[model samples]
Target: MGLAIGWTDAGIARLLLPGDTPADMRQRLGQAGGSEKHDGQPELAARIAAYSEGARDSFRDITLDLDGVPEMNRRIYRHIRELEWGETTTYGAIARWLGDVAMSRAVGAAMGANPIPLIVPCHRVLAADGRTGGFSSPRGVRAKMEMLALEKAASPNGQFSFGF
Candidate 1:
């Protein structure tokens, strides 16, 4: 599993696809042969580390530069961000929240196309049946399950600490 992050003057520019090799990420950044470190983005890197260690809800505070994300998809992402760290909700439920039950599949597809994964908490969105749904992370559903478990363990109610 590989994690590559991109940063910009505003904040994190994006979370590159989890499966991208470091070289792939570098090429995307137009810095293929250069150092991974940027001039002043240590805070962004530290936030990623904090999330991995389960010591922080880094997404809660980070500013994401989602310049070209579609409006509907952005709406879905906003709702996903509102999801508690450990509590899981269904795609259908999100669609319903959007005032359209028919948009469940669209919600799922939006999640699959999410450019910033962990920040949006797409892992918290499951199938309506409560099974782990598709996760585009490098480890797929297993990664989603692990994230859920980690957050659950971190909270007394098995819900994200901030959920309540």
Candidate 2:
């Protein structure tokens, strides 16, 4: 698996997960107005690598460049970023926190549109019924589940179980 990240002067702007070939990743990065050779933030890259290797590294301190993100999505991303390793939340729970259960779909949409996935931790959001919801990664739900498993994430009831 290959991973690529893009950053702006503000902070990290994008993260491309595995599933694309190295060449494809480079092409995508180029299309996104970035060069594959830009390693502007090596420390952040190291942290991401450590986390991917099963370390409990937290990205809470890392800054993000969300210049064009909608206000609502920014709010949701902030909330999701607070979730620690091994913790999980439901889309409905996030919606309720936003003061409306009806916004569950909106929360899901925001998660889907998230530019930074692992760093923002959108995979931590599950379905209201406790099932793994949609993940925008190319690997989809499988990738989301893998991330949960990596964190040994607990269910909403506080019991650890990846079976969900």
Candidate 3:
């Protein structure tokens, strides 16, 4: 597993999760037009590393640079960022929060397009049937499950329930 993060003056701009080779991470970052420099966010990097090791950090206070993202997607990401550790929600629920349950697919699309996965907490969003749904990380749904498991393990009671 390899992790890479890209930061901008505004905040973190992109994150490549564990599971890719270093070369793959570099190429992906380059393709996303993010600089390969890892010098900007030492504290954040440390937090992320701790998170990968199953430490609890809601990360809600972290700022993100969603400059090119559409307004709807931004809204979706904001809502997702409010989800606490070990909490999970359905795409349909988020769609309804957006004022239309029919927008479930749209919510899924927004999750897929999210550049900052862990901070945005896209893995917390599930399918209406309680399925893991899609995760765009290199490890795909497996990575999503791993993150959820980590959060669950970090919970105070070592337990969590699905919502909506």
Per-model C-alpha lDDT, please? 0.70, 0.85, 0.84
- By TM-score, highest first, what's the ranking? 3, 2, 1
Q: Is candidate 2 or candidate 3 better by lDDT?
A: 2
Off by over 4 Å in 2: 157-164
lDDT of 1 at 71: 91
Worst 10 residues of 1 by lDDT: 155-164
Candidate 3's residue-wise lDDT over 1-164, tens digit each?
36889878898889989888898999999988897885677888889999988888889999899899899999999998998888888888998899998999999899999999999999988875566778999989888878988877332233333422
Clashes of each: 0, 0, 0
* TM-score of model 1 vs. true structure: 0.78
Candidate 1 vs candidate 3: which has greater TM-score? 3
Q: Candidates' TM-scores? A: 0.78, 0.90, 0.90
Question: Tens-digit lDDT track for model 1 on 41-80?
Answer: 5676677677777864737677776766789998888777
Sorting all predicted structures by lDDT, with the top scorer first, yields 2, 3, 1
Give the per-residue lDDT digits (tens) of candidate 2, residues 42-137.
787788788888999669988899988999999999999999897899999999999999999999899999888999999999875567878877
Measured by TM-score, how close is model 2 to the native structure?
0.90
Error of 3 at 133 (Å): 0.4
